[model samples]
Target: MPTKTKAKSLPDGQLDHHAINEFKDVPIRATIEENKKIMEELFKDSSDIVLREFDIENGPKAMLCYVDGMVTTSAVDDALKALMILEGNAFSIDRITEQTLPVTQASKIQFYKELLTNLLSGDSVLFVDEQDTAVCLGLRGGIRRSVSEPETETVVRGPREGFNEHLRTNTSLLRSKIKSPRLKLKSFVIGTETNTNVVLAYMAGIVNPKLLEEAEKRISRIHIDGVLESGYIEEFIQDQGYSPFPQVQTTERPDTVAAGLLEGRIAIMVDGTPFALLAPFGFWQWLQASEDYYERFMATTLLRWLRLGSLFVALLAPAIYIAVSTFHPEMIPTNLLLSIAASREAIPFPAVVEALIMELSFEALREAGVRLPKIVGQAVSILGALVVGQAAVQAGIVSAAMVIVVSMTGIASFTLPRYNAAIAIRMLRFPIMILASIFGLLGIIIGVMVVVGHLAKLTTFGIPYLAPVTPVDMSDMKDVMVRAPWWKMKKRPKYMGTSNVRRQRPEPEQ
Candidate 1:
């Protein structure tokens, strides 16, 4: 037995003013006029809402309601034309859905909230005169950017296709790479007002179930008004909140996402954004790049060493220069020490002060360049750094040695493959420089120790932040320190969500 819906007699566009109790349990009514009035009220200020009223020759009267920019008008016209020419004395929901309409997704709506939501979410709702239920036609259409190589994560030799703003499009890109039933995507609608779709993707057998559960649990607890980016989801669900380092990695490349999936990591994709979050990330991964695996293992391994040296220079070069020049001059050779002394004799500021001035000026110039238009930004950054450094040296504001060290450190920071990881190193340089100014070399040691301890304590969703090295997983070092030949590497990193540990089994050579 079903309860009949009583039509509410209210003025148009008055649903918002009504008390919550008035429509607490209201459902779709048998009267089409009341439903139309309710929908019009909900979408009163929206001029883009299209309500197309039509009649069947020998059947029930119906009206189509949808947002303008969300759906294709031609598809709606085709479906409406097919329904109007149907040969029937009465309208049957099943018959109309099966034969009359060419729509692929037509869902029946019984509740008022469901009706309104479907209408707002790019689906056209067909309200009938006598029916107690409405039909939701899937006709979403809008201007979306086509998939192309991401400007941020572009590689020399890899798939150029990248994730677009559409969630379905992003999922399809991943699915095209790994065509297996094991790949699973579980969706959850988050955000109270936005109702943003957040999806968790991973391989069913390869991904650890516990890791999946933890990720799902954290995301479910996020109750908010909206989620504008994948970063919002990352902030809410990351393992550490106070840590400066990014516990979760974000990438625009589908190949990177696919590789993360194949390695038994979970990727979180937020609707309306292209950047996806890959979880259980490690510290070593920050130093690696997409091209590392694309090239020869030996060449990749050497590049990894270069990146490691660059990271060191980016963080400690300025601080070390100040320390050695101010407190450890004995460590320098006689000729170099005499040369540095001669350079700094006419400088107005001490080594620490000079370094700080140059670093701050460089940072300001870097920010200015980034905010400017792309065409002029790179030229501005390069010219600004060069002109400022050279002028400051000639004016005796900063020594030439200081300029050289600052320039070298700036160049080293750009060596990093990912910008997010480079940010952490960049932020730490200032603090280390301050310590060197106060306590000299010992202060630098203390600062380094504190940062190392913080990183050791940090975790990316329960996996050790400093894994394979601190815990000494020698097998994992093949890909971490040096990119071991793919054939030589047989097992996946342990306790990091890899289930099918065997990646490839090479035949033994005699």
Candidate 2:
């Protein structure tokens, strides 16, 4: 005999528990009805929830359960029509079992847990009364952005379709790209209250077991109540808790994720977020873009170097200016120095004060441009920069040379691939500028050394943040400083813990 207990505190107040002894040696047909009764009890209070009850004529009566708005109506309708109208004439329980349902025009999916998992995933479940099993029909729906190019990662050449919020759709997009059986996806639910789904994707046999284990362990330790975005999980699971630089990179492009997986990096996909996280990221990783892979190797390499140069200019240009004007006058050309002195002769503020004022104003204008509506933002930024620069110079509050230097520095910082990394540079600029104004070139060197020391201490998933450079891997440098030809990139990134090193066969001598 089976004992059932009703749940009082649950939302439905109908959750039922059956003693294991009652189900022992029981027929599957009997077990299914018992399971249905339990589910009915569990979901009683969810009135909007839909559960379709139908029969296979002379065979068995069954039910389909799904959340109202989470499933496609058309899909469920078609499935019901197929079961009731198409197969209604033939009503044998054996005809509709998992083994026979596909032949009888219904998709047959086995495994009890899989059925429950699919049902909970917004798919309609078909429960045949006489049979002990159920079939979960794949029909998911929810409000999601239409397929469009990613705003953050716009490409002049390449696939423009970005990942959408829908997890299944995103998985499908990835699957469509890499049809190999080597591609593996493992799912876990995080968050005690939210129960948000987190998926780990990679190429099995290629990915290092150690890396996978570490990633899994970190994710499992997350004790948060909610995981609303991929970033939430990233922050919780990143190796270093103090570094401002991002240890995990996020991308909206399926191609990027697929490429990363092929190279043995783990891709984490959170349920509600379109952005996926990739771990074991390096400082230089932020500087590379998907466009780099799409364009010619030479063009890509040149653009990368240009970005690197721009980064230096962004970080060091203002400090250099302050140092030269305050203490290093000899480093400046005699004519340029004379001209700079002539302009500064009328300025009321010191070199540091002028630099601070201009930099702060530039940052404020940039923020305004970002927050303002798209139609007016560009115009506002351009006009604001021109008016502020001209007014300050004309008022004798700042030198014309200072305005040019600050403007150039601002523009240089904008060239960075990652916005966060750019902001980090922007923040460090002020301290370096102040130090340079106080101690000239010596202060600048001290600031650089401090920044480098901090970077050396930083780690991303146990791998040094400045890997291949600080550690100095000659082979990895082929891809880091320059965009190597695809063939030359035969091995996976050493930091990512990929078991399989080679991606392709080596070229034979011609």
Please tell me which predicted candidate would have the highest TM-score against the true structure. 1
Instruction: Summarize candidate 2's per-residue lDDT along 173-277 as a digit string, tens digits.
Output: 899989999998899877644567889998898888888889999988887767789989988888777766778888899999988888788899988888988
| TM-scores of the models, in the order given | 0.93, 0.82
Residue lDDT tens for model 1, 1-510 = 985344354455355433322343568878778877776776678899888889876787899888888898799888898889886546688777666788999888787666665666688998889998888899988778899988888788878888989898999999999999999999987776777888999998898888988999999999787888998998998888988888999999888998889888999998899999999887898888888888999989898899999999999999999999988899999999999999999998899899889888888888888899999999999888878778888888999999999999999998888788888998999999999988989999999999999989888888889887877777778889799987787777775757688777767899
**Candidate 2 residue runs with Cα over 4 Å from true position:** 1-48, 51-64, 82-120, 125-135, 495-497, 507-510
Residue 303 miss distance in model 2 (angstroms)? 2.0
Candidate 2 TM-score, true structure as reference: 0.82
Single out the weakest 10-residue window by summed lDDT for candidate 2: 19-28
Clashing pairs in 2: 14-41, 14-42, 15-41, 28-132
Compared with the true structure, all predictions reach lDDT values of 0.85, 0.79
